[model samples]
Target: MKRTWFTHPEPLDTTTANELIQRYTSRQIQTKKTLAFDPKFWLVSALLPEYRHEPKPSKQYQNSIWSQ
Candidate 1:
């Protein structure tokens, strides 16, 4: 099986990046597989601050998650 990882080009604060890394890593472990993330994931998570829900797979999820 293939594994995926996501990151951003823009610089990130140490704390936030660490948090994201931890979250992604945990997901990888829970799924027993590697996960892929796109630039949009990073942008949405970082800029919006509302997309912390698991099993979220929609633009509304994106909007709601970031809205916070």
Candidate 2:
């Protein structure tokens, strides 16, 4: 089967683009388990903003070090 990739026109920094690509790649890998074909996964992702690229504190720890 033919495969196609789509990207938005909004300029993405290298980090943001890499994160988005990783998300898409993982989704594609998970699709292999599905019994039926679905395009909604990719569609929804495309519509959503790439917010995952931002650096955030780890949930496992607090910012005590930085608070000093």
Candidate 3:
């Protein structure tokens, strides 16, 4: 954890890490059913990038309303 992006005031020991993971896992269990069956979920996200080609933004795009 040395030279990482974030600096924690906390000392992250094994027990604290396990507790954090359990909290996250509990949240996912509550939301998993809804996200898994949604049409605009991971499947479309994964496939769209492969099948669709998008134009790269030019310098002019910086001032365009679309950028906003």
Candidate 4:
């Protein structure tokens, strides 16, 4: 990816590049962590008989999980 991107003439300044890399790395790390409030997990739980009363999947619910 870096090699291909290097083919482009436009270059990001050092501070901007570092900030971008940092944000990307932070997101990658966050995605790797287990999130208890994740809506997808709750949806599966809701499907189970024991958790039938759990809230249904909605845009707000899913977004809440991913936004973390």
Candidate 5:
């Protein structure tokens, strides 16, 4: 994984890249919000259910959760 992308570089695709970035950012925001709301165990809030199944964040943080 380390420096491997340099050997087999991924093709440039801004559309796909943008979508992936947005989804990743959205999940990160959700994870942060979940932990903030509970402040309990951390890994439980991130995984164990699946990355795509992260607990939904509050409305204030949800505006950016799913891509428009």
Candidate 6:
């Protein structure tokens, strides 16, 4: 099945985005009971000015943290 986020181009409203962010930060998956990673953490954090800090690791770093 195609992902809604991919099939649709509209960005989520602030309220929805914040809810998703909170769910991720708290490690509470509202959609399902199983724990899963949320890629939106970085995306939403980046849009907010207060979330300043070192950026998330790149794909290369994610693949091999010890190599570089």
Query: Could you say which candidate leads in lDDT?
Result: 2
Model 6, TM vs. native:
0.28
Error of 6 at 67 (Å): 48
Better of 1 and 6 by TM-score: 1
Worst-scoring 10-residue span by lDDT in model 2: 30-39
* Per-prediction TM-score: 0.34, 0.34, 0.27, 0.28, 0.27, 0.28
Worst 10 residues of 1 by lDDT: 40-49
Question: What is the C-alpha lDDT profile of model 1 across 1-68, one tens digit per residue?
Answer: 33343335564455566676677556553212222254323321222223345564677446666778
lDDT of 4 by residue, 1-68 (tens): 11111111234444544454566466552111122343232111111123335576777546666788
Tens-digit per-residue lDDT, 7-63, candidate 3: 223434445544654664565521111122333332111101222445775795376
Question: Model 5 off-target regions past 4 Å?
Answer: 1-9, 29-68
Which of 1 and 4 is the better model by lDDT? 1
Candidate 6 backbone collisions, by pair: none
RMSD of each candidate relative to the true structure:
12.7, 13.1, 17.1, 19.8, 18.7, 14.3
User: Which regions of candidate 6 are displaced past 4 Å?
Assistant: 1-10, 28-68
The TM-score between candidate 3 and the true structure equals 0.27
Per-residue accuracy of model 2 over 4-55 as CA lDDT, tens digit each: 3333535555455556767866765321111113422332124233343567
By summed lDDT, the worst window of 10 consecutive residues in model 6 runs over: 1-10
RMSD to the native, candidate 1? 12.7
Clashes of each: 4, 0, 0, 0, 0, 0
Residues 1-68 of candidate 5 have per-residue lDDT tens digits of 11111111233244544454456467662221112233332221112122444477668756565957
Lowest lDDT block of 10, candidate 4:
40-49
| Model 2 residue pairs with clashes | none
- In model 5, what lDDT does residue 46 have? 19
Could you tell me the TM-score of candidate 4? Answer: 0.28
> Which lDDT tens digits does candidate 6 get at residues 1-68?
22222111234554666676677557642231212245332233322223445678667535465658
**Candidate 3 segments whose C-alpha is farther than 4 A from its true place:** 1-11, 29-68
